[model samples]
Target: MCSGGFAKCLGVSLMPLAVVCVLCNILLFFPGGTTVDSEHITQQVWYFGGILGSGVLMIFPALVFLGLKNNDCCGCCGNESCGRRFAMLSSILFAGVGVMGAGYSVVVSAVAINHGPQCLTKNGTVMKWTYPFSEGDYLRDHSSWSVCLEPAGVVSWHLSLFSVLLVMGIIQMALCAVQVVNGLLGAICGDCCGCCGEVSM
Candidate 1:
């Protein structure tokens, strides 16, 4: 298959993944489907991992990849093949950007999962927003989840959403990595079967 077609397929697959990351991040702001003060939310949610990292950053690369197929240039010093190669080469930079973004999201999601969620918990007869779990301790002990007095099941909510983000981030990273290789191959070989223009009979 032509490199452009392969890139287009990758781009199509990335779009939905990016959307899912954004949606998951947004939902993280509202634990257990209930709204709370912004300050009470987990700190990691503020990092905008899924929003900026996975969602926005991934969108750029996806769009670039999608357009690569139609980026057939005809008037570049009368070197259409050279122009196509350059276009593919340029996509490598975008793929690198995507890798970085996804990596950021993965890091943030992992940290958030480890730190657990911030929720109202009783401390010596006083209630305040605090992280009840220490470094993923709550993941093993479900009974400890009672520490979070408000937001109702916030621990589970946080874990689920952040886990989704982590998985999606990893997937995004893998896809971008693949694009890096694809871009390199496209640059080295140019588009296959006269992908830039119709073959002369």
Candidate 2:
């Protein structure tokens, strides 16, 4: 593997990861769709936007990495050619997407906390999944206006999963930044400094 091979690996890995995260986030909100809650709509939009943005941002770099792997050409900078420059630019874009995704994940986690539908039990009582409120309060506030019956635990679980994915995205972004710096070093120092040159990672 060349110096930017690690970056190529990361870009390849991130594409599928991003796809999974996007699906999970969308599924997380689908259960709540029956309710006309504006908050829920906003949450879904943010999740979709951020996750999809990250995934889309990764494609160009991933393609560039593939080109570098197959071309076997050397450009002005090093043995890898213009692929390094393209990788740097794409990594920077992915980093921005990752930051936005992270912030959006925080919002999703906050909104999802104790937020669920009010359900009626066989015992003639209603309950909702809300925090800071006791079971007694949950049983009492079962408003008739609520249309859906969803388990709070499931929604919470998906939200947690999505949050974890977002954290992973952030880490990938950092790795991309590291790759950018590595490429920059290689461009500046060339073969003089082995740290950034065409060496195996």
Provide C-alpha RMSD values for all models, in order: 2.8, 7.1
Q: Kindly list the per-residue Cα lDDT of model 1 for residues 1-201, writing each as its tens digit.
A: 788889999999999999999999999999988999989989999999999999999999999999988854332333654577787899999999999999999999999999999999998989888888887888899999998889998999999999999999999999999999999988876756454355433
lDDT of 2 by residue, 94-166 (tens): 4455545544544554444334332322324745332332223333454522333343343334345555555
What's the lDDT for all of these models?
0.89, 0.47
TM-score of each: 0.91, 0.55
Which residue runs of candidate 1 sit more than 4 Å off their true CA positions? 71-81, 193-201
- Candidate 2 residue 24 C-alpha distance from true site, Å: 1.2
